[model samples]
Target chain A: MERLSPRIRPVWLTAAIVQAAVSGGLLVGGAVGLTRATDLADAVGLAESTVVQGAIALAVVLAVVRLALAWLRYSVWRFELREDALYIERGVLTRVKTVVPFVRVQHVDSQRGPVERAVGLATVVVYTAGSRSADVAIPGLRPDRAEDLREELRRLAIESEGEDAV
Target chain B: MSRLHPVTALTKTLGYAVQWASVPFFLVSILSGAFDVVRIDWVFSLAPVGFLLGAAYGLVEYYRFEYELSEDTFDLASGVFSRRDREIPFRRVQNVDVSRGIVQRLLGLAVVSIETAGGGDTEATLRYVGEGEANWLQREIRRLTAENDEIEADEQEGLEPDPTERPEPATAGTSGDRRPTHLFELDQVELGLLSLTTAKLSASMVVAVVTAFGGDAALGLVLSLARPFGGPAQLAGASPLEYAALALSSALYGAVATYLVGVVYTFVGYYGFRIGEAGDDLVYERGLLQRYSGSIPTEKIQTLSIVENPLQRAIGYAGLRIETAGYGPDGGGNQSAIPLAKRSRVERFVARATGIESGDFDRPPTVARRRYLVRYSVIAAAIVAAAGAAGIVWGLPYWYASALAVLGAPVGAHLRWTNLGYDLREDHLLVREGFWRRRTHVVPYYRLQTVSTRRSVFQRRLGLASLVIDTASSRTFVRGTPTIHDLSLSTARSIHADCRERLEDARRTRAREERALSVAFT
Candidate 1:
């Protein structure tokens, strides 16, 4: 099992920031209108003050929870290549284990977005047709490692197919 | 290339204007009617005015639309008041379907649909064109495409043929150098037989009629029928004799109606079904009133499936479908190349065409951890009992509902779990599914686009993972459940890794072989 390093937690932090910004903006705007309807000295029961404080608190809590979950996810997620198949294990509370055989592999694709590029990481999306939902995206891979893994997987797929053909 | 007639814009705009204007007219009518509570005469005047306006708008748009054509493209520039233009490339075209409505036929015009590989959203259509020009365009597109394919194939073979390899001796009589690439064509008898087995005549007719009537009329009819037959009241009380008589009469009526509808459906859907090989491509032409012709290059095919319904199984018939990269023009993701076929003949035809041996794949395994029928039966029984209970609560005859539910349990269960099987072998993966129409998809390892394994929380508890194999064709999805051989996570990971390695090796080998051949030839 190979786990993603804790340093990758920045991606989750970025997501949290975006979420908070949007939610916080809406909450603050609503609160501002409520405060305007009441005098600040007697604003204890003002809708604006309550709404703005509640929203900011919720955002902060969400960001904290997100950061904790990201840590757990990174620590739990592991992928290992065995002699004949590829195995992936992940999840915090509910464990998921998937094993894909080499012979069954059709193709492999690698993608990188700005966020991933900034962190010098890439994602690999493996697709299968057997199930309605067969695409699995493995993120947080170093580009060189991703390329190497891709080549290795391709080789295995062809070899297994050849063996089966015989 | 031809340009659209300038009048086309006028007609299109007129049509839109009519559509928009109807809203205001209807609103005014409703408002006037509301005011009629005070003065009824105003309502009468407004209704006629609205009606007249709508009719006038429709008439104006009807005669204004037109289009233009060129050697490599077609332009549809139509609008009245506000203009719009659309350009379609001939090369991007996948199918040219010509349809003649009664009105179009009377006017000596045909509607041409130009379909492309892009999903259904971007297709271009010509609402009305001269019948002669429509026919000419269809033929021209087909001819150009065929020529392009031939040239491509020749380039592929000529560029790489090894010197050590002996050139195939040119056949005598018909252009020795040019092999008559057309390999097979279905005559009327074959086409007729094929249609007999796979054609859902009634379903086709329903679809055609619904399309003809448009969406609203179709929805209205469905709602009318479903209102009475659907829901708990359907299973309610009756004496045995009365129930039997009702069933008998309904069955008799249904049989007669179905047969008549089937005839119309078959006639309309598959009026002139034809399958032939043109160069290296398989060309399929079908339709009753609207003739559609499409061609698929052999190389584009990812998988071939042979499906057999219980009725077809008894008659030794099958349906042949080819899975390709793009969505099919006729709505279905998988194209029915030979909609209905003789099982034996279709197998032989595929083998000859692809140079793949017949009977190379294994039948899906029948044995499983448990009999699927038991699970199906249990679920069916539960559903029936629940329905019967619901009926009883609704003040229906409990005994009658109970009897019907009990009788339906086995049948329901059997249908649910029927024909679920998967088999993995060397070279290919085979999956057979579907209760009524048993379909066996044979996917070659080479054509696979992706391989994946998934496990739900429940599956993980059972120590099972589902394997999925995908191809370029959107239709084919093969999944093996319960983790074949109870493969462990590490084993599965390694398997995927190995598969990826093997694919690369094969590609390298193929590339090396082609290089060697090229060098040898030079």
Candidate 2:
């Protein structure tokens, strides 16, 4: 199994940080809203400042945990180009190992989302004929590399001469 | 081009009248405000006009509907104001089903629906066609599909899985050698047996139907009628043994009701279930009030599923379902090819249909057995905890009784592990699983769409993974995707590679075979 490009680490970290920040921001806003709009803290016999402090503390803890797990997730993520199929092993808690044979691949595409674009990374997606687990994606690759991978898989899929028909 | 049967005018008119008149009638009543504040009794007159319009629409549809059988395509033109025309190539036609309800049957008419490769909806439907025409259309389409294969084989190469060329199916029909070889016919005894073993969940639908027809008052009346028998249980001096006996007898009564309901359901659904082989096609005709005659090319069958419930398994009888890419009437791609058959006969049928050999399954590793034991034990413990929690909350006694389930966890786990096994053969992949209704999915390598493996956190620690094999069939009646619950990571990878190679090899061989057939055809 090959790990994703080392460059993907920063991009994943950025995404995880942004996600955590947004969630933390929402928590802060909710805490402020509750303190201002209702006497929930007073009714619960707790000070408003304590609620805000708790939100900030919980936010920091969650962010730290999320960023730490993100590092682990990056470490665990892997993709292997087998002779006849593309194998991907991912997920942190629940490990998923998927093998999409070249013959079953209907189409392939290389996409660069905002986060990926920010870090000069691209993702190559393989759409298979199967309904479930239809889209297989290889994330955190250079644009040129993603394009090359897509072309190679497409060529292999074409060469396999799958029925494409039932 | 030919118009729809004249009977459609009458049939569609009746159908539309009911459908259309109800809307205006509903609006008029709603606008009338329970006939209190608003006196719009004159608005009721609009129902007749709507009915007339609907009748006219139906008649126009019948007259305007025109279909033509060309050399390669089936053309259809219909619709009122917006003219819609569809041209379906014979090659794309997956299934041709002829079905009829009471009205159509009485009128000697059938609704012929055409199914294609994409989506769940029926591609084209002829409202009411002559029974003879429906049959002819089915036969003609099959012939054209075969002819198309011969012509397109050279250009398209091995892109299509040609169902017709395999058995030289259509030439026999063209030569007028139309003798159909009978495969399986459901008998009275077999139907009864099938009904008896049916899931009680469906039998509860009998109560819903009864409620729909007779209302809640009737149900209350029934309960009241049975109150005398139930009253004995509530009697102040009732013995514990009497109460236990009453509960047992009531359970028996419920079981009997389920059997009776199942009898009616299966009997109606599969009354004259007769499947015969006409060339390479399995032509099935079944039903009591609503009859259906559909043909699924044996070569196009994606998967073969053998379902045997505990009772059926004990009696050595099983149900076989034939799945193709074309969706069936009930949104599934499976047809009950053999609703009830001898287990041995079912095995033979599966072998004949997909070349799936009957052999011993390779059981999962010893860790899988331990995994099941651990899972079941946890579940049992959870139930005991929940029972205790509920007891404390509600002040209920006998909370300890639920703990007894933990003792049976080992037996449950053993049975579950023993039942789960898979056999990867040369041409077919057989996966047998499930304890209650054991389903053995026989998926030919030719139909293998994709294969994937997954493992949860607990499984990863145990070095175990699950394999999921998919086919082109979309209906997730647990149809094409047969999954093996537990296998070593290395074994899973090997199996995945093996499956991928086998699928490619099978397709290559099948393509070569088709090329050879095309050469012979020309």
Per-prediction DockQ: 0.11, 0.36
TM-scores, all candidates, are: 0.59, 0.78
Global lDDT for candidate 1? 0.55
TM-score of chain B of each: 0.65, 0.85
**lDDT tens readout by residue for model 2, B80-139:** 899999999877777789998887788889989887765657889987889888888888
Total clashing pairs in model 1: 63
Per-residue lDDT of model 1, residues A13-58, tens digit only? 6876777677766766666665676564143434555666876787
Q: lDDT tens string, model 1, B1-522?
A: 353323344454566556655655567666667765545445455555555565565455444444556545666665545667776655445455666655556667776666554343436666666777776766666555444434443454576676544333312111112322443345566556554544354465565554457776644543344344332223357444444444444445445555556655555666666665544345666775655655554444567787777877888777677765545544434667666667787777555544345543322223222234455556667877765654544433443454555555566545534455545544455666665767777765565545555554444555544444545455423431212322344544565555455544543343333223222211
Model 2 regions lying over 4 Å from their true place: A1-83, A107-127, A133-155, A162-164, B13-21, B24-65, B78-85, B154-177, B212-214, B225-259, B354-357, B478-480, B511-522
lDDT of 2 by residue, A1-166 (tens): 8778888888878889999999999998899999999998876567999999999999999999889878888888988888878888888877777877787787899999997887898999887645564447899988998999999998998887744446
For model 2, the interface Cα RMSD in angstroms equals: 3.5
C-alpha positional error of residue A41 in candidate 1 after TM-score superposition, expressed in Å: 52
Q: What share of the true interface contacts does each candidate keep?
A: 0.19, 0.66
Query: After TM-score superposition, what is the CA distance of residue B199 in candidate 1 from its true location, in Å?
Result: 7.3
